[model samples]
Target chain A: MSRVRVHNFSVSLDGYGTGEGQSMEAPFGHAGERLHSWFFETRTFHQMQGRPGGGTGADDALASAWGPGIGAEIMGRNKFGPQRGPWQDEEWKGWWGPDPVFRTPVFVLTHHPRPSVEMAGGTTFHFVDATPQEVLRMAREAAGDRDVRIGGGPSTIRQFLAADLIDHLHVVLVPIVLGRGERLWDGLEELEARFPSVESVTTPSGVTHLTFARP
Target chain B: MSRVRVHNFSVSLDGYGTGEGQSMEAPFGHAGERLHSWFFETRTFHQMQGRPGGGTGADDALASAWGPGIGAEIMGRNKFGPQRGPWQDEEWKGWWGPDPVFRTPVFVLTHHPRPSVEMAGGTTFHFVDATPQEVLRMAREAAGDRDVRIGGGPSTIRQFLAADLIDHLHVVLVPIVLGRGERLWDGLEELEARFPSVESVTTPSGVTHLTFARP
Candidate 1:
């Protein structure tokens, strides 16, 4: 069976996956670029932007883990764009510009579904109103032999985690204290039991890579 | 001025300082020594329990930092014992038995104040119902020229942190998730500004020692 994996998901010291009051101007709200600065400086992120030259340290190695083996991606609408509750503008082609980095079928969860948008690169956004199980089924079908990735805005990942749909989880624990924001581990108490084997490594950049997996 | 400090404070990956259902039998509740396992293996903790021979690594070095600091210690009532609402037993001389670990004046915050208890060692338990600021003043006075330590039960540390009384904070980030319990970070949003300088080092034991100091 193909695995359901989450990779390089960053969170603050206080457990906030993303800062509060997210908007178009500040998608991470009060958090700014603090949550993802590690990824942004990495070669993996630079490569994603189709750029050259980036950090070649432990951080880059962990950040690079996000791409491989991921076939299809399941994301919340918030990650697709800042618009909430019945899309404000049809022209909003996501924060990733005309050519999104996701070079696969992206299943976005939304209350008000819209027609699919085929972007440059191999990316195609499919907005759908479906449960985590239903969406996972669709993503798994689309993923084929490769693994399905759970792209997060926190809530989507929490729902899938609660449903026990995830097989491998990779979280980057950033040292900065966000104080207030959307938490990744709110309702999932004793979440370690689901994935018995866990490993952690902290890089020189002061971020710890926590990987939880089932054997 | 006597500096206020907290050291070796253990918190889970999800930010829980302690676990739920705390009692006399289970001091750390369902967490069950999981949070303090790093400390337990450290030579500092072994020396605290009057034992010898523990891991002589980075964890031990950081654990040893809890001592040496300065004088008096202020803590929440919960850290003293499990009993609540005006205390259950007068015979209960705290969890430390006859001779407590804290050799300095220990001020315990409680609603119902009681007469001070002089233990076998130099340790003295002073129960007072004072605000964080007021307690800090008292602790500073008791500490004299030496620094004052802010012992925690999460809430105690949070209170001191809110009052901007702590000069040094050392938090041990344990790689476990306790879904419920008192959180140390709660309302301390943008707390990073208070401490201008911060440093972190991950030990071989997989625990990160995060130090925030006003430099």
Candidate 2:
């Protein structure tokens, strides 16, 4: 059966998934950008950017799994950008340019309203204003039997995990610490206890990749 | 021998360590808060804050490594908070408040000059205007055979890695793609290829932990 999953999220040593104060200028934050250095140098990343003769290996394999054939994505408005206090307008597509990195249809959870954004790739952005189950249903329809990925910012992932909607989760561990910032998994002990098994691999770049599944 | 190390700096899957525009209110930026969620709940973090009974097993062990060290600490001026050209005075301490996180003598790498900020604890923030090697020499003196840690933003760690000054590195990968922003390992293919040995572990919160060492 197709499942909903959260894949390849990178985090810091201090438990901060990111650093404080992100903006279009600095994206991750001052100290947060060091998280995904492993993936950037991968051959897959180079290939995606249309660069020639990049790489192919375990790192490339991991990068290739990042995107491709994933029918749909679900996330919160915060993941889209830093806008708060009601949707200002659709002018802010995202930090990404006209076309986002994801080529699949994306569902963003928000209390506000916005139209769908069609990018150069096969990707489209859809705004969902409902409960986790409702969004999951919509994403499943959009995804068919392929699989639905819960692309994140934290709150969105937490809500789905809280609802037991995710089937598999792949977390990539980057080594660093932000002394302060928002946290992922701050209080999810009850939810995590339900997972039955996990698989792990470590990248040469110091990224420990983990895949957790529930029976 | 006590070696210098850089561990667990989390960046967004997007390439940004921290997000763009940094401000006092939204220090990490937009959804960047999701990046470091793991640390806030770690026992290591709580203990640093003088709170008791607030960490998970793996989380506590990692958090404990963050503070209460007699060794010297290193940081970029930006971590001392925002910078405007060179240092005009010695008054600016840090964003961490009176007690500050580091209780030992700290070194701030800057192109400017300023006197050290001595705190109640053994902490004293000193601004250094020299190469990393020079800073290392002074830090070793202050550390006195204890370990020296590279408290960083991406640039600082990259410099250390490029110079091969770090002997040990740890990474914690959370899952998320910033899709835009600064990159941690923007140009680190050679460094990654050199440090090939790696080890991994995972926590209940879906964070994959990794440690890399250069023998």
Candidate 3:
């Protein structure tokens, strides 16, 4: 069966998935790259940037697994770009330039639906205005035999999590505390009951990898 | 120099120290004993209850470190009892019966201060209406050569942490997520900057122990 998974999603020690004041200039706001610095140092991230010589530790091991079984991804509008309201210009592709990391069918949840964008590589951006369940259905269909990944900017993850759509959730707990931002765990009361099998491992980079999987 | 430490403070994956709706019946509020269940299974906790045997693994090892070298404890009023507003009756000596786990001087912070109550053990509950600094000074004086522990119910920990008074902070990350509760890391922005050295180890009981210490 195809699974809905969240992989290598980094959050602050205070549970902020991304800091406030997110803009094109600062995607992670005041948080900057601090939340994902651990991943940035990983071999997997370096490979994504078409670079060489990156750390090959436990952080890389977990980060490398993010793209394997993922055939499709569902991300929020905020993640696609920092634009709000409607689509001002059609030329804006994404933060990842021409070839996005996700070489799969991508569903972007937004109120202002736009035409499907065919980017370089296998990544295709499909703008849709639907519920989390609706988007999951579309993503699952696109995923086929493979799994669907819930790409997050915090709110997107919380919506999917609130709907109980996630099967395997991998969270990297960064040591920094953002204090204020989009919290991933908000309104997710008693979320642990869904995921019975919990595992945690600390990487050399001072981040703890926590996995919550359904039994 | 005497170090101010926080040991074996358990929080949910969402960083909630305790659950909502705290009352006399439910000391930990809706969270109940869920947050501290890992610590409760430890041999150190069993010994606190005067039990025969308990697991002496990593969980117990960390839990056992809570009492030693701690001459005094500063806890929030919420930790003392469920009674709010003015103390209805001075007879209400705390949830702990005749003898309490704290064998040292315990300062309970409250706006409505009352007379000191001496329990069976060396535990003496002193109600004080003072700032975190004032209380820390009092606790430091009481502790003398020994270290002072910040016994928390979350908000109290935040107070000391905000004041930049804690030297060593030990946190046990429980897998559960209590959706609504008083979070521990609300206003502690970039708290990890203070603690340069961080160590994490997963116990056999399925809880990750994270310790942050000042250099």
DockQ of 3: 0.73
Go through the candidates in order and give the clash count of each.
Answer: 0, 67, 1
Q: Compared to the true structure, candidate 2 yields what TM-score?
A: 0.54
Against the true two-chain complex, what DockQ does each candidate achieve? 0.68, 0.07, 0.73
TM-scores for the candidates: 0.97, 0.54, 0.96
What's the i-RMS of each model?
1.4, 10.4, 1.3
Query: How accurate locally, in lDDT, is each candidate?
Result: 0.89, 0.70, 0.90
Q: Model 2 - which docking category?
A: incorrect
Error of 3 at A126 (Å): 1.2
**RMSD versus native structure for model 2:** 12.5
Highest-scoring model, DockQ:
3
Model 1 error, position A107 (Å):
0.7
Runs in model 1 deviating more than 4 A are none
Q: Report the error of model 3 at residue A192, Å.
A: 1.0
Question: Each candidate: RMSD to true structure?
Answer: 1.4, 12.5, 1.5
**Candidates arranged by DockQ, highest first:** 3, 1, 2
| Candidate 1, lDDT over the whole model | 0.89
True contacts kept of 1: 0.60
